[model samples]
Target: MDEPKIKNMEEFAAVSGISRPTISKYFNDPDSVRKSTRRKIEAALDRFDYRPNMYAMNQNRRLTKNIGVVVPYLADPFFAEIARIIENHVLSAGYRPVLLGSHGDPDLEIDNLENLRLIKPAGVLLAPLGRVSDAERLAAFCADVPTVLFDANIEDLGAAFVGSDNDQSIGLIVEYLCRTGAPPAFFEIRNPVNPNANKRRAAYIKSIEALGHKPHLLQADGEGWEFEQIGFSEGTRIIQEHDLPTDTILCSNDRLAIGLLSAAYQAGLRVGLGDGCALRVAGHDDHPFSRYTCPTLTTVSQDYAAIAQKSAETLFALIDSSKHFDSREETLFNGRLVMRGSA
Candidate 1:
């Protein structure tokens, strides 16, 4: 007679003549079981052609081994790269990573948090919308679930924050520009989306003033995450109007610098440190595309690997502790200046 078909882990355990707890332990980590037991389980699995529903199994547990990773905009290569790194770390640590993108929408961000909550994730690594984020909602979520903020930060929130130190980064770039060429005019969107932009702007001013140069603020009128578009349109206007206060232009971010580079090329203005180059350009955030630009952008490189590793480790610590810290923690990695033909 043929054997009975197994429909679930419980049924499989019965058919294999193994205790349910032993079966679950083997499923969770095969290495945890004795070699003979593992072999038997493998044989049983092959014979019955049965596999466990990991998600359903987790649901029965007090806490699911799921880590939520939320970024304001996943379309940005920077965030995508960081998220990929974090995902790998989470997987290696034996947890599922639930990645979500806010797409620069506040409402969608809240919805993503709610969805993660429903699954009862062990913890969350979030790169919030900064200024536009709903702090009250975020606080409530953090109170219930362990969350570590990365990239953009909101004051006094999350179990901890891990990101690049804009002050040191902007200062490094500013000093480099002043030493090599004319002091740069800071170019940025007047109403920025990420809080990092504001921090960069302030750092630029402080650095320039300390170096005894008048800081030139070139505010572009625009909104949203279309940084390239804003950079191009505003760059064209600034170039055409001859509004630049200095020969060197340091953009708040690489996306804006890219737009400015395009505008300069279209306007027939040579950009580089070479002789006869009409303008010298530099930017923050060594965006993936920055190196591929015609002149090869000179910018500050954020420590993507460090930030991802620290954020994941921090969240995991919080999850393992099953409680919030005595006080909030914040880790900021310094940026390195990258020299290229653009500046």
Candidate 2:
């Protein structure tokens, strides 16, 4: 005769003649139970195939092993990539990862956090939509749940912040451009979505002025995460209308630079360091597709690996100790300059 299938821990306990609470304790941590009890549980496991629902098991416990990872927009490859790294780290540390995307909406960001609270996650890793995020609500949420902010920060809302140092990154690219060729003009969205854009703008101005160059701003018109389209549309208009004040252009990020490159191609303008090239373009983030553009692209690469590793480690430390840091911590990784064909 075939062995009976045990549907859950309860059924297994009943067949093994073990109390349900003892079985529950064993499932949580086998070492917590007495040796004889553990032997009985192991014997029953050999006879019957029973696997507890991890989610259900966590639901019953006071503190769960779930780690929530929230990003501003998962559709963007940058956020998706970083979220993947953070998830792997959380899983390796023996915790469940619950992923959520805000889609660039503040309300949705808040909703994601609220949902994470329902599960009582061990901790949270959030890449907030800076500037647009509701500061009061986010602060309150962080107060109740231990959260480590990454990517874009919102001041002192979280236990810690981990991201790239915009000042160092933008300055590195700016100095490089000034050294090799003409001082580059900063290209940015008139109304930016990420707060890092503001930092880059300030850094560009400061770096250019320090080098004794007059900074020219080529602010484009757009909002949200459609950076490429904005860059293309605005770039084309600027080129056609003879609006660009400088031959060298430094986009706020690589996605925008990619679109600008397309625009330059459309305008019959050659871009690169080679002879006969009419323009030189560069950007930030060293976007995954930057190297494949027509003339490639010279850009700043964010230290995503370091940011992800530190954020995960910090959150886990908080969870394990059940204690908050005496003071909030912020870790900023410097960006590396990636020189390609574009500039």
Candidate 3:
């Protein structure tokens, strides 16, 4: 008599003499299992002519193998670079990455969270639009999902937060600038959107004071992420009106520095460390385009690799253990100063 037909994954697992969990693992990602296990499963599949229903299996599982990665703005190269690293790590861990960008909108940020919830993702990595993000909604979402916040953080809103230590980074650049030339003035948007800007402003003040130099702030009037335009327009006004407190300026970020560079160039001001140079410019975050500017920008480089790795690892740990931490965790990496012609 012919052997009985295999009806389901359970029957196939029993006949193949493999554990059910291992069978499920192979089905979820064939390469996830060892080569030996894969060959055995393939042989069994050939003999039984049975294939697991992927959709049904995912539905039955307690958690899907999908990891959601949401950022405040995907257009920003900084976010794009970090997201790419996180995506690679997620794929390597046999989980699918679902990437979403809020385009710097708080309402859209909430919408992204709600959509992720519908998918029932195993975990999430979020970079919230700080200061504007709905705190109550974020807190509620974290209560239900395992999330690791990166880049911009909202206090106590995720399982953990991994980001650059703004204090250390700002201080590093400030000390470098003060040592090289006259103490630098801080330039930033008057009402900033990112939480990091506030931290950086405070850090600049603290560092300058420690070095016995008065802090000067040049607040530009504008909103949203059009930092370059704000920087150029305001920088032009400052330059033409002779309003700059110091010859050297430290922008809150590279985009602003780029704009300031343009303004200075248009005003016939030389920007560099050599003779005939009228001004020095520096920025933070070492933005992707910073080095390519006419006079390369000097800035502090955030430890992007470390932040990405730690954030992903933290979320994966939470998912695997199937538990939240007793207390929230935050890991901060220091920045390194990148010296160039601009400063």
Encode model 1's per-residue lDDT on 129-177: one tens digit a residue: 9888899999999889999999998988899999999999999999999
lDDT of 3 by residue, 22-70 (tens): 9998887798999999999999888877877654676777799889999
Candidate-wise lDDT, in order: 0.93, 0.91, 0.92
Shift of residue 164 alpha carbon in model 3, Å: 0.7
Cα lDDT tens digits, model 2, 266-285, are: 99999999799899999999
Better of 1 and 3 by lDDT: 1
> What ordering of candidates by lDDT runs from best to worst?
1, 3, 2
Superposition-based RMSD of candidate 1 using all C-alpha atoms, in angstroms: 2.0
TM-score of every model?
0.94, 0.91, 0.87
For every candidate in turn, the CA RMSD to the true structure comes to 2.0, 2.6, 4.7
The residue pairs found clashing in candidate 2 are none
Off by over 4 Å in 3: 1-25, 29-57
Ranking by TM-score: 1, 2, 3
